[model samples]
Target: MDLTLAQEAGGSSLLSLLPFLIILLLFVPLFLNGRKQRRQMQETQAMQSALEDGDVVITTSGLRGTIVDASYEDTIDLEIADGVVTTWLRVAIREKVAPDTTSEDDSADSSGSTGTSESKPTIH
Candidate 1:
């Protein structure tokens, strides 16, 4: 008539917390996902803002280029390698490349054909 009352009180007290605990469990992932998404968006924005002229960049299409311009409207002009210029949306840039790094050695090829036929038959 004394110790039994304390045990019964403890058991009933824990029941009230069950629903709150379940709600917390369900919301945890959703909260974490939202925070992660927000961080990703901020990172994207920072990357976009850092774009500058002469900065080599890779587009989402796997195309590589140097950034000729970046606009607030979320678009940029890319100078692909040398002499190939193209316009792209800011979101299309997947990565940035250092401007000084280039595989095409300027000394090895001087005025070479850019994948286009320039041969003209000699008229005898």
Candidate 2:
């Protein structure tokens, strides 16, 4: 009789913990994702604040340019072309562009064969 009561008590204890376990499983991922997003936002803010003249950057709108002036408090002058400078908000800058690798990629692409593998269906 004591063994039966112990088993029943153990099963009830586990059932009581089941809801807590389910809630923990559901919230842990959300909490982690929020932390990750906050970290990314901090990194982006740091990058924007660290901008200076002569840094080559690409804008959020896909415009690639060099930073000609960044002395303003909330904006920067980007030289997109010779004698063509544009004023953009500091937040518009996405990231600094890496050194040119277009030529290398172009050479590799041209050396490979460009072909299609589609075949026409045969009529019986």
**Top candidate when judged by lDDT against the true structure:** 2
In candidate 1, what are the lDDT values of residues 3-84, reduced to their tens digit? 9999989988898889999999999999999999999888977887788887878887898777777765778898875677
TM-score of model 2 (CA atoms): 0.75
lDDT of 1 at 99: 45
For candidate 2, lDDT tens digit of each residue in 30-116? Answer: 999999999998999899999999888999999999899999989999999899999999999889875566557778666766675
Clashing pairs in 2: none
| Deviation (Å) of 107 in candidate 1 | 15
Per-candidate TM-score against the hidden true structure = 0.64, 0.75
C-alpha-based local distance difference test score of model 2: 0.90
Q: What is the lDDT of residue 21 in candidate 2?
A: 100
Stretches of candidate 2 exceeding 4 Å from the true structure? 99-124
